[model samples]
Target: MKLFLVRGTAKGTLVPRSALCEPRAPHFLHEPPARVEFLNGTGAVVPCVVHGSPPPRVTWTTRAGQPLHEVPGLRHMRPDGSLVLPPFRAEDFKEDVHSAVYRCLGTNSLGTIGSHDVRVRAGERLGTLSV
Candidate 1:
C-alpha cells in the first residue's frame, strides 16, 4: 500500500497555504453613522468600524463626492477608521457650507462597502446672558 502526503508549496513555513488566500468582503460591526452634530469652533469625530477576513482600508468622502483629505485642514481620516473635523471658525458659519453629509468607505480585495449618509451639523454657539 502507498501513502500520500500533502505539503505546502513553501518550505519551513508552518502557515497553511489557505491562510494566504484573499480576504472576504467587509461588513459593518454596527450601523454606520447616520448623523452627527457639533458646535461651532468645536471638533467633531465620526466613527466607522468594519470587519473582514484580512482587514479593510477605510476612507472618507463628502456627500458631494470629494475626498476628505483634499479639504485642507478641515478633514482628516484617523487610523481607527474615524473621520476628524477640525474646529470651525467664525467665517465657516457664514455660508453654512461646512454642514454637509459624509460617508465612510471600506474596501478590500473582495469588494467595497459604503456607510450610510452621516449628516454633520455645525450649529452656532448661543450667547451667554449676564445680569
Candidate 2:
C-alpha cells in the first residue's frame, strides 16, 4: 500500500519506506502450553504473548467466557500481558483455582483473536526435595 505524508494544505509526494505501516490482525508471539504442571504453592505462569500494528488489549477468561479478574493476592496479570498465578500457601490451595482452563483474548481495532485452551494442574509438593 502507498502512503502519503501530507503537510497542512500541501500535497505529499515522496514517503519514506519506514513510514509504511499498516493495521493488521493480532498474532500470538507465544501461547501457553496445552497443559501446565506446577508444584502446589509454587503456582504457574500462563503466557499470552501477542502483537499487532496498533497493539492489542489482553484479557483472560474462563472456558465459559466469563471475565476472569485478578483475585487479589491469589492471581494477577503482568504488564506484559502474562497471567501470573502467584505462589500460595499449601492450606490456601483451592481445587477450582489451582486447576482450570483459561483462554487469552487479544483484541485490537482490526479484530480479536483467542489463544488455545491452557489447562493448569497443581500437584502436592511432598517434602522439600523433588524427585
Error of 1 at 28 (Å): 1.0
Error of 2 at 30 (Å): 0.6
| Candidate 1 accuracy as lDDT | 0.71
- Tens-digit lDDT track for model 1 on 44-114? 77889877867988887778767776455667778989887778776655222357778888888888889
Clashing pairs in 2: none
Best by TM-score: 2
Cα-based TM-score, every candidate = 0.68, 0.78
After superposing candidate 2 on the true structure, give the runs of residues whose Cα lies further than 4 Å from its correct spot: 1-20, 126-131
**CA error at residue 22 for candidate 2, angstroms:** 0.9
Whose lDDT is greatest here? 2
Give Cα-based local distance difference scores for all models: 0.71, 0.79
For model 2, residues 1-131, the per-residue Cα lDDT tens digits are 75466544455556654454678789899876878778766778888898987899988898788888888877788978888888887787776667788889899999999988888767676453223
The local lDDT score (0 to 100) that residue 91 gets in candidate 2 is 80
